[model samples]
Target chain A: MILLAPWELLLLMFANFFSRATCMTVGPRSSMGFETCYCLSWRVAVEANNAQAWRTVPAQCVLYVENYMLGGQYNKDLDVVIEQISTYLNGIVAAGDGKDAWVLDIDDTCLSNLLYYQGKRFGGDPWDPSAFKSWAQRGLCPPIPAVLRLYSRLVQGGFKVFLLTGRDEEALGVSTAENLHAWGFVGYERLILRGPAYRGQSAVGFKSSMRKQLVEEGYRIRGNVGDQWSDLQGDFIGDRIFKIPNPMYFVP
Target chain B: MILLAPWELLLLMFANFFSRATCMTVGPRSSMGFETCYCLSWRVAVEANNAQAWRTVPAQCVLYVENYMLGGQYNKDLDVVIEQISTYLNGIVAAGDGKDAWVLDIDDTCLSNLLYYQGKRFGGDPWDPSAFKSWAQRGLCPPIPAVLRLYSRLVQGGFKVFLLTGRDEEALGVSTAENLHAWGFVGYERLILRGPAYRGQSAVGFKSSMRKQLVEEGYRIRGNVGDQWSDLQGDFIGDRIFKIPNPMYFVP
Candidate 1:
């Protein structure tokens, strides 16, 4: 071994730490720092719907969740899911009878609340209904580009797209529609918000009842897409359901 | 600035590179190399049940998948899921009724096929039924420790546990039961396997029919756990569904 200057020794130590932290290792655990490895597992658990009814993001994972939401991984994950949906759409031989329909969840599926979530520490803080309502009332949430593109494709493919959300219809009906329209979420057959009939129902119950009604109305739900598991579960869930990753929160 | 020795310059260069490669940044993309990020996104999509009917793991992601399956992250992820299940089980009032039942899937859920998968490139290669059957006939797959523990807790807590699998009864019945027994999987109410009437049925169909029969027979399915979504979907899926991580293969 050769002698090194003090600065050189510090640099060498830094390199070693970095290498140990970044490189993936084949063993009982990854070489990533414990925080990173644990947070990644937590996020995967959330996306897989194994960790249910989590009220808020773990405090330690706020930054991790923030980076993931704004980082390219979130967009890339969306791309993969959209690719599958596109492939499925291409394979469908649509019935000329006009009964083919598709369901899409509004928040975080068609429109992203990233701007609102940013202020809430990416869901590190408890949910504030009034705060979220004010944010939604502004009609400023941006369209999730990939989901917007898919919506366009579905409309063009002659599939009747229904925009469904758990937002109270009496309070948010106008603003939500305007926000959606501003983002070119055009041509959807219906925008079904939570009307008085679904006042006390859970998200799963509300969405399931809506889908059941759509089925009874003679529509064949070819596919359903949502950022929450509640949107894809329950009766009449359709032929194929695509789950978009949303670790920031769980609906039920 | 002070001039440095040649070795110091080399060390500084390495430190810079490592820092750039390892540090998590708040930006459009993570600082991780493109391969690692893309493979991670792919895995997430698969786990979220968005990437459907994938024939084999992406060739480039074979090593990534191997690391994830063998690495400590897999065990930690299992721990998170098991913790949730335990919390739920502890909260049950139990009604003191013997009808309280839990359903669990076998391959890759209760028993891990990692040994065979190691030789198969961690699902880099296409599935081979004959080869897998041969491996199963050996009755050598080890128990997933976390699941084995959960099974014991469920049994001791007065919940009837059902061991369900898509494995064929005629070919794998004896070996599978022996392997489970050899690994301390005792006191299960029944070991369900694919029999003659379910020969060509898909996993969702066969498992759904069985659960429906269980319901008709007055078994209250309190919880269902499986590595595959097919095991958790369809009619009569239990009150709670726990999806265990299995990135190695897709059943349907």
Candidate 2:
């Protein structure tokens, strides 16, 4: 049996509480004069989601995620994640000759906004941009341990590492750099964030162009890792794509 | 928040334990002479499993599902399910004349193997045929609460109900009948089971033939409910199909 800590168990129960509440609709329906407590279609979807081998959350459940990052389930899941990533990185290192690089996504992958998310109650309140920028300016966000370990090791071993995030550089240039430096993450070839001109662009399109430019500059991205599909959906997706888990809120 | 009884919480956890344990591989791999703790491919699959919106479980985790059927999750999910089933049944009753029937796949649909699965630990051991037969012979399987309620109401409202199971008639006929009667289920026109001659047939083939026979008898199947893909896959899938959650085992 997987040994979960006592608080971990509580955290799991806490995390699941959100998913269970996904289908709770108002009003009991009277079917042929029989009063029923739940909505049939939503209930079927809930059960189907549980029963299927795989499931995408209902479109509605994406915004209400309450405790995904706070729970240990997310981190424990990532432990298995980085182990596999380390294995793959080691393979690419062995197989390549030279000039190999890796692409990394910033938010929720390299740096976590655990505290900010806690304050936001995992997306219950509408997103406030000024508050987010103020939070970013604090540079208090921490490096995810597994990703930090992998990145530091990769850089020290002579691989060119690039930070490719969707955050706009005009908005977060110095703050983003300081945030990375504040958290023991340093020494990357380029910390590429979106330019002001690229505002309102699709993540897939922007990231793809950034990667294309990198490839044209003769750098081969051996691996790409991120939490969102948009981060990995574009064309120059590299030799391997390691997706970090982030079910709290969808970027797209 | 959804209210979960203590035993229900335990049961849900017990059910989930099966799916989680499935993907823990037997050995560590040598990636470029760096010994890894587990199969890197499998570990990658595990991470990928967590990353995707919906996912077919890694072959490893199907048996270790943690909280799928307990903690009020299952029953709460079913509320929506029966609502939909009732709607479809009501539609048939409104739209059609008489001779309408609903097809129900037995296990995990019309009748539940909740106790048997609980006792067996959701299929942990190598399946023992003799042990299973002995368990089935006891005929204590309870009806699934939501399905039983829908069925009884539909039957009382004048729609024919048919029980179509994959179990062999010679082996489970009396036991299945007795079990249904124990749950206050009676007066169905037929309880169809796979005959000895259909032993080598595929489920889709067997079920298809059964439905064909019923259709030839001038019966109009209004709806069908099941827990597996094969149960709803063939030609005579009827007017509507409702699937129940059963990730414990794939029947086909």
Candidate 3:
């Protein structure tokens, strides 16, 4: 690529900065695909140790995530993380106690609810509990390929994988389990759903607390892979915390 | 920070590229504390998701590793991976199967031997069999804190921690056992070092063969943690693999 002239580069930089500084697409086209500062300067930020540069994540990162998810970038990016995990697994010689746990989060982590998110246009709607519940009851969400492969390989490689999601246990338990099973997330140790008691709690607090319980119970969580940072947040998080991309919606 | 003009940004980029392109420090102090493209770009690379940018690793990354080893960065970096492991373990509800295994490598993985590496300035000297063998015989190599903690925790977590290294089992078996026990790596399942049969085999071939044997015997490799890539290499690897930094030497 030809180097940009000083003036031309400045113009491009200003345009990039302008777009991120505004919620320009928190409207009709938000989920259709939008660009962000991350998509602009990620290369420079990635190769440099400049912390300041990496902090350039777009304010409307969900838009970028939408595009990345629908575009080829998502698969390429996921492939890299998968390879890294495989490399990590290759070195592992499991404890074989059958207590080795690979904790997976449900939502965007295991099953990509792109359909819902796309329709919502990146949180364009609010508190439609009924509609969301109806979506879950469909029991038809597809499994994420990368996570599915990781889950299956890990089981063969010595881990007993489990799903620990924040879904309301009483309401979503049956469908969640059914959806997962039907979607090829066949054999897991358990599907731990949040109960009514967790109604108003924060994900971090809830997950951290629940994971603490797992530790106290004698389980050894070897790997926790999730899309949201919230999925990975909290106490007793596991041996490794791998955060998959999710700029769509902030749990907090 | 004020935004850089196009020219200024290009200048900085050029400088970084120049530093990495030359054998600038492949000299008297290459292993002392020289910087590499990694050190230069680690900050930005740390947080960004640009796989291509992050893939620009230095060819002589070992030199960069030397500084990181002596510097506080090594511990800090390792702490992250370790804490992640702890979190996983916390969520683990173990199977209590008598066959769970946590495979560990000797030499650089479990034992530090930093004194020699530092003296040699990160593989500065050529092969010194007598010196290395003598050092091993000293039975005084220190245990690495990060790995030591993982070992201890896995044991308490009901894992049958085992020593699987490239060291000669027949020659170093007694001393290896003695050294590990002496250094507080107590109560391992078994110390499987290379025997006469492994004399002419490569580390990858030998280790892979042994791990495969373990699998065929129905032993589950839950986790394998090591410093060298070779330690983590081969078939029948495990459930999860962790890599500790070691830029001093390349096993392959």
Candidate 4:
């Protein structure tokens, strides 16, 4: 290698530092010069249910996850899911017996808690139950527009829509229902929330038990939609299960 | 708008064309001035099992899929899954009765067909059964390195490893075994391929039936890993199910 002058060496060092800084800020690089976005991989794992029981977004990925949540990509992703749901809905022959039913998880599926999550580091911080409960009491969660459209279609098509959630019934039931109504989630047959019966139960256990109760009630559960795997898993998990994206937190 | 000279107008038009071209090549933008990578959304949807019965990668996403598969992210993603699996394995108290089993899917999980897929536009082309069969008959597929490592650990840790695949047994039994053996997967307890009894069955049906049979044989499936959701769905899905990424193709 040719030797560089002092000034030339200083300039080269500065250039290297600038490139390294850019990589750290924009995208991370592996030692082999391969750019690897671990945050994207983590988010994909979470979506696929491969990564289970995760409590928080990785610290390093907080900004990345925040951007992904607020970015146009999240809405576009929701649109794709909605398109698929609409296509599936089009092919259904509604029995018109008023027993044909659809199941939807409320939080992050019907009503988004993005406003509360915005202050929670987009799930980078540990879960705060009381803080979240207070936020729920305020009843400010917005409707995920695509899901609302799907809900309206389901309602008009004569399919019974059931909103199932893990929210505490005693504390936030009234506010939750009002928020859902304000956001146009009306016409749903039932809004089921976690009651004393489901206290200390896992999301999978509670939701699956509730779904079993629905099936026992003679409701033919046609489709299930949720942001968490727990909401879509276990016995009586309808004929078709649709998992929406939720990189923020895992229910179990 | 201000009036412009002919040369100035030409320069402005050129700039606009350049920016538009850059956007097209780098990312497709929505009309709302938001850059959206539909391809990334599609991949995420696929991983989440939200987009089901997909035949191939989206035409526009072929390059993106190719790069993701060949680039470092794929391996990084695998590492994340393996990390989770390893952690789960660490917590298990093996019975030491030789009935504790771990199941893994073959294609894309154990033996990768990446070399063959490289010629098929990385699954952008429609699947050709005869061509795929010829490639499998050749037995040149390589082991996914990370999975092989996991396999070795499982074997050494007293877990009976089972290799399950949808390949036809009559045509590919010997070659598939040899391929797996050559790839350092020699310690697997059994290599189960699709036989005549399972012909024309869906992946979910065949795999679940086989798993049920395994359970009947007094095997306790502690963990199951596969690149397809079909491998993880249905009855007897074991205590833990791990889904490895396979954006290149969907089995069902």
Each predicted complex: what DockQ?
Answer: 0.40, 0.07, 0.03, 0.31
Q: What is the TM-score of chain A alone in each candidate?
A: 0.90, 0.73, 0.75, 0.87
Q: What CAPRI class is candidate 4?
A: acceptable
Selected candidate, larger lDDT, 1 vs 4: 1
**Tens-digit per-residue lDDT, A1-252, candidate 2:** 345566766765544433332223334322311211122224234223222211333344333233224423355456767876776666656225547889999998999987786776554555667888889877788889989998898888888889999887987888999999988788888999999877999898999999999999988888888877678756888877776866544565
Residue A215, candidate 2: Cα error in Å is: 1.8
If both were scored by TM-score, which would come out higher, candidate 3 or candidate 4? 4
The sequence of per-residue lDDT tens digits that candidate 4 reaches over residues A119-215 is 9999999999999999999999999999999999999999999999999999999999999999899999999999998999999999999999999
Candidate 3 residue A208 Cα shift, in angstroms, is: 1.7
Model 1 compared with the native: what TM-score? Answer: 0.90
Q: Which stretches of candidate 1 lie over 4 Å from their true place?
A: A1-32, B1-32
Q: What number of backbone clashes does candidate 4 have, counting pairs of residues 3 or more apart or in separate chains? A: 0
- Per-candidate alpha-carbon RMSD to the true structure: 3.8, 13.8, 15.8, 6.3
- Pairs clashing in candidate 1? A28-B72, A29-B72
lDDT of 1 at B21: 25
Models ranked on TM-score: 1, 4, 2, 3
Q: Residue B57 lDDT in model 3?
A: 36
DockQ winner, 1 or 4: 1
| Model 4's DockQ score | 0.31
